[model samples]
Target: MSEVTDLVEMLEKTGIPMSNELIEALLRTEPSDFTDFPLESFWHDFPVPFLVTDSGVTKTISAPHMIVTMLHHLELDEGLHVLLMGSKGGYLATLIDIICGHGGKVTIIEPHDEIAEHTSNVLERRKQCGLIRVLGKEALEDPAWDRDVDRVLFTGSIREIPDFVELLIEEGGFILGPFGGRIQQRLMKKEWQGGAWLETDLGGVVFGPMDIRESERGFPDPLFIADEFEDALILISSVLGENSEEVYRLERLVESLRELPPGLPEITSSFTEEEIIEHPVIELLMTEAEWLNELWPTFVDILGFDLEGIVPDLEEPLFGKRHADFTP
Candidate 1:
């Protein structure tokens, strides 16, 4: 089989879906051209957000599932102008370059000087430097920056959509980013109308916080945490049979929140699993599950049993302290 077919098969076997167009785009681009590792060794069917800098900061090459989802939402067309806000690894930028071809222009803004230089050097070595621009500074600092872009994508998470982002968009353009703080986040889509921006929730995602100068502090907004908690509850309920009163209550709450508006109040930080468990709703559900003895595999699965230390710690609070004080 061809290498592209192998990649497609691998993604399918691992339950990571991608559109045929994206699969073909991946086939056309060479992963080795962008990364330090060999493509054959590094390409795998998993969400591998690897560290790209010595500072321990990482970038999501975005699993095939996320790439496909983001592309679908962006509605990208050939020759459209694109601006990428981060460039820790040039994997996603490289893919965008291929899809845009010779007609489209891609400008990358990387705040970290070392990573920006490294990415530019690699692309140059591969002879793919033309039709692309890499700036090693804050995105807004570049005087030559184009304000009218057809699409914008931020590879990191932000607490709120910045006002400047709208200024960067041409009328009717859109920006996609992971919105929220550490521990909890959601993929958000924002489109520019003539005078206002329209936003949509694109579901949950895990991402590192945006590399801004200001530090994010404190706990996430209660409403945001509640929304994410409800999503987890719904997922767990789906596997455990969704007919329980607890599930119904959680669903109703989620629905009510959805009716409020597109954006939730801005949150500064995120809740630990311990803090999440302390919520009255979560406590009530756990107690109910224990009463029926249905909290073993289901709860363990949602929290991730094989995730090493994370699951064990989560188990202690919900199942352990509440029951026999089991320690694993």
Candidate 2:
């Protein structure tokens, strides 16, 4: 296969969306001439498109810019501790090693024994062990590692952000990862604050699932909140009023939320407290008798939509109860 074909084949597995610009950028690289460093071999040719390309001797094009762009929203500085969950080929982890700079620390967690060993060897050759620590074990149960990590970047898809990660970040610390499944893949950033989390959907992208298998049984399946659904609810609720069939759709929509699959691209939620407050949909929904009641209003409020009304007595006949009587 041609180099471009080979690179594309490698990147295909990552499941990240690629534009023509990204593809063209990667096609220009001379993978054969990449450094003898093993990890360098795993770097995909820039899959970015519409960029100039030339053939020449081996020259290094740093991906820190790309990596930083991927992680642009995150705040980093000296003394910050970072956890790189599911460090796979170590491409992203290596970039973090560079950006963390001196005195900063990065811990790479990988479960696949072979890849873990290979990554360990590669880091050892690069003499990056001082700044980067490779863990060939489970990240979830590691009690010795600092829980107060400044950031956690899961290069793979996560069905949910692990509670361990929640404990790791200081108040106001940020976490970035891909969540959902095949069609719902997206990048999400979350910030911890006083007793709550402020989450923003950065946009959509592809990624792979973490290799580690969960030992716990009966965990909920992953379900994604779609941007389209959120927008649809707002549009229908606003223009159609709370009594319209759209209200039923919105209620069913919220009820249908399932645990999202790992590696799904990020998507916006209809119930976003932020969007509803800024949009006109909440007001229209608030005018209705069914929606104006407490249970629904509280749900809207917790999601960040503000409307004045008496709280409803929310109950699911089949399930017997609901969790957020006072969410909003």
lDDT of 2 by residue, 1-328 (tens): 2754665656655665554434443454333332344433344544221112143212222342334346455555556678887654454555455556577788887765555665677566554423888886465576875657788887666667777677778887878887764334678888788868889998886554543544231112123223323434553455557787646756664444432335432223433544443333333333443443423433343233222221222242111122242333
Q: Where does model 1 exceed 4 Å of error?
A: 1-3, 10-21, 38-42, 47-52, 56-60, 127-130, 143-146, 213-328
TM-score of each: 0.60, 0.49
Q: What lDDT tens digits, residue by residue, belong to model 1 across residues 63-108?
A: 5556656766777667878888887467777777777767877788
Best by TM-score: 1
lDDT of 2 at 13: 59
Q: Candidate 2 lDDT (Cα, whole model)?
A: 0.52
* Residue 114 error, candidate 1, Å: 1.3
Task: Give the range of the ten consecutive residues with the poorest summed lDDT in model 1.
Answer: 319-328
lDDT comparing candidate 1 with the true structure: 0.62
Q: For model 2, how big is the CA root-mean-square deviation?
A: 16.1
State candidate 2's TM-score.
0.49
Give each model's clash number. 1, 37
